[model samples]
Target: MPDKPRVILDSKQLELTINRLCYQLIENHDDFANSAIVGLQPRGVYVSKRIHEELAKMTGNKNIRHGALDATFFRDDFRTRETPRIPDVTELNFNVENLKVILVDDVLFTGRSVRASMDALLAFGRPQLVELLVLIDRRYTRHLPIMPNYTGKMVNTSLSERVSVEWKETEGKDCVKLHTVKK
Candidate 1:
């Protein structure tokens, strides 16, 4: 097993960020009533669910659609790994054709994952627009120009540093961490 990294965003900050993001999403989109939140599997899924719940509370309606997307197969580096993990099925019950789709993720790193996610999402249906929402935006060496429309926070770090996001679905905790690999 590999060594885990350091802790960055604690429980308090995580909750605060989520609330702020929820408000931002509501404020930015005038037609949020017809919007759908799609979370990238693993951490993104959890974050999306939380936001969905918050939106429902604020709007006093439970019609918000939440979807989970797994983009492992769509990754450009998929074939490079010796043993790649099989991707989970992408589940978007509603048609994305003319609806607003919000893509949620835990961390924004090289932007490769976001790029791959977009490719995977296109297979479902062409949406009117797609916005990115990320918990932590660690601006490092980005190969693509992808940017998050709703970002919780921005942290600067070296190429060797890593940002880990943990949620109840996977880690049974809600927090974000920053760690550096041992040289």
Candidate 2:
């Protein structure tokens, strides 16, 4: 039999986490006039979009600007990987110049993605600040010194374990899980 996945957050918990995250974001960025929410592609896009929608609904501001960023080319391991990776769609219409940018993603692993995201974001105008938001913070796995400014959950796992986040946009349900191979 295959290794069973351990549930970290169920649908209810996921919703609550999202709502809490939205509230914390509002607490930090009231009205969000000087802030921009950018989601990392392709999995991070779901969390980013969810945050954008919830934050807009919470604040009743339809003009909350949200964008999607792809970090395929900016990744340090892209060229070194055996298989070639395809770039995803990047859709950021608004400029990030001098604005506080919140980078949203599903999980924070080795911190390489966040580093790559910073490089990718620099293609656009420079932002006054950039903060990271992740649904799951995998602690003690940082290949680089990166931490999430806003996190839904923090978990400690061994190197052999993997953390997976699923969303309704892609997985038809929202949940977080830890997966480990059966020895």
Candidate 3:
């Protein structure tokens, strides 16, 4: 049988983590004058939107450049998956050329999404810098050499487990959970 879901971050804890992440982003990208936050499409948008909103509230930069990227087609496994994938809308209104960019996502699983995001981002324009921000970083499972510059939490998991970030926007709550798959 599958293991019961484990709560990694509750609502209050999730809020605190996000607050701390926003401050960290501010510390590194002061003024955010030339930096943009791009949320990976699908699930990552929830975390990115929240981060963008928090950053605006804390930095008072109501004009922060935040956009969503859909890397469905850019994924390396796009042609290998048995199920077809539907593409999401990409709405990056600002140019990333010569700018610093932070890629945001709810969870960093195998790093494939991040890789695809980077590839998808290139179509916009080459940014001066590229960093990653994730609500949950699942260690030891990365197939690619990718890591988050800003992470809310780092978790160690096995191949039989999965970590997911739930947002109130879509899941009715803000929490992180780890699920175990039956072998």
Q: What is the TM-score of each candidate against the true structure?
A: 0.91, 0.96, 0.97
Better of 1 and 2 by lDDT: 2
Q: In terms of TM-score, which candidate is stronger, 1 or 2?
A: 2
Tens-place lDDT per residue, model 1, 1-183, is 334876778888898899999989989775476688999976688788888888888777688888999998889996788988788768899898888899999888899999999999899888999999998898876789998999998989788788888876678888888888767
Compared with the true structure, model 3 gives a TM-score of 0.97
Model 2, residue 161: distance off in Å is 1.1
Query: How close to the true structure is residue 6 of candidate 3, measured as C-alpha lDDT?
Result: 98
**lDDT (Cα atoms) of all candidates against the true structure:** 0.86, 0.92, 0.92
Compared with the true structure, what per-residue lDDT tens digits does model 3 show for residues 35-77?
Answer: 9998998888888899999999999999999999999888888
TM-score between candidate 1 and the true structure:
0.91
RMSD of each: 2.1, 1.1, 1.0
Cα lDDT for residue 26, model 3? 97
lDDT of model number 3: 0.92
Off by over 4 Å in 1: 1-6
